[model samples]
Target: MSSMKYKSSEEFHDHLLGAIEKKRGYHLKRFEEHKSEQDKGAVDALAWAYTLIKFGKGNIKK
Candidate 1:
């Protein structure tokens, strides 16, 4: 029996696009909210800090 399981590369690409659509709105909202170098840099730094704190394997506790 045949199924809609993305049997080909093109089919897989098209199938997952709708999932990304939901994030598109959030992406644009974030882009509009931060239109300054300092604002963008701060946001980026917060992300980096969060990654270090959460996934740093407790190495950056100092």
Candidate 2:
């Protein structure tokens, strides 16, 4: 069997959530910086991060 990086499922879930949150924060900052320029790509990335976090928060279980 393959080895698991996380000690347990809850740990993995928390890690995943943290990663998504970090991405969201990064994209939010980028979006703010580019908002004056009307950057579509930055907006899309921020939206994607928001959607992923929303879904992940609702669907993932410990």
**Cα-based TM-score, every candidate:** 0.38, 0.53
Worst 10 residues of 2 by lDDT: 36-45
Candidate 1 least-lDDT 10 residues: 53-62
| Candidate 2: tens digits of C-alpha lDDT, residues 1-62 | 99668777667767766776676667667668766444446556656865776566646554
Candidate 1 stretches greater than 4 Å from native: 1-31, 57-62
RMSD of 2: 5.0
**For candidate 1, lDDT tens digit of each residue in 1-62?**
87566556555544444444444445445757876665455556655544454454424221
Give the top-scoring candidate (TM-score): 2
Clash pairs, model 1 backbone: none
How does each model score on lDDT? 0.50, 0.65
- RMSD in order of candidates: 12.3, 5.0
* C-alpha lDDT of residue 26 in model 1: 51
